[model samples]
Target: MSLQPPVYYIKSEYIETDTGNKVSRRATIAGPQNIILGGKTIISSGAIIRGDLRRTGPGHAVVISLGRYCLIGENCVVRPPYKTYRGTFNYYPMKVGDHVHIGAGSIVEAATIGSHRELIGDIYQSKFTIIKDCAKIADNTVLMPNSVVPALAHFAGAPGQFVEDLPESTQEMVEAETKSFYNRFQPLES
Candidate 1:
């Protein structure tokens, strides 16, 4: 008899999306708002997403948009930037691209992350990080605002910057890894 892959035992705290995304119940999405989820993204437990805040628009503007294959780690906060408008404070829209992974306890004020470094653990990521496609980050790296990371690379250190480019062979590997990570979390059958 053929064997099935062993089912991973995730805590009941996770809510799996129909499009293959896993959102931890403990994670704060702050519904009643416009937080877009691209596809196959994972928001780990304790993650806080401030979808309630955004700039004024046609009454249906989107804020904090996350792309496919993205991961938001535990206790991380994803919020849009805010500035004074007409003597009033307002937040702007933030967009995270595909195949991105942000580690735990990070504060995202920018619109993008991951040269594909997938910010894995606690990190200081600012609003100005420019990560190209297929980038990877080493643990404990702090990504400051206005920094740039090229594609197919690795990032590390405080105020984290793109430190090294991954070997070309790893490109396909990262793609596969992204798919695998998305598939790894499944809803427990009731």
Candidate 2:
């Protein structure tokens, strides 16, 4: 497989893509196993991605599987346990859909974050934090695990409360903000 910068690792594994993707110098991806990243994905600097996704029977860990065209911010720590058991193993693999934007320093694991989920700040995501598509999680927001954030909902605050239904005006504003932020530091295409 062809890597953009061609950085070195002690022991790393990846799938051979027909087309190469550009991985920024600022990004830090590490793991003991394979780091599977899809095509056209931008992994910025300071982003910590762990590749160990499987469980040792009863022992748990966070496995992050992101879809295509995802933008994961800098300094983000996404670690969530996939299985839990009170005598029996609770198997729940973390899954993120396409076109999702996860902000910096956000800890995401457990459940399924649907497509187009916009999350910001520090999320103390639990084993069952299920967010639907097109949901907006404000900066510094924390989503308690097992709680569901409805689609098109506008959430804000430290512990993340539903401010109100996400209006079109608010959506427009968020879109604009997102566009501007990414534009400022757009990844270089190889």
Best by TM-score: 1
Error of 2 at 6 (Å): 23
Q: After the best TM-score superposition of candidate 1, give how far the Cα of residue 151 lies from its true spot, in angstroms.
A: 2.1
Model 2 clashing residue pairs (backbone):
26-45, 27-45, 62-80, 84-90, 128-146
Listed in order, each prediction's TM-score against the native is 0.79, 0.68
Candidate 1 TM-score versus the reference: 0.79
Clash tally for model 2: 5
User: Could you give the C-alpha RMSD of every candidate to the true structure, in order shown?
Assistant: 3.8, 7.5
- In order, the Cα lDDT scores of the candidates are 0.72, 0.62
Q: Model 2: C-alpha RMSD to truth?
A: 7.5
Q: How far off is residue 29 in model 1, in Å? A: 0.4
lDDT of 2: 0.62
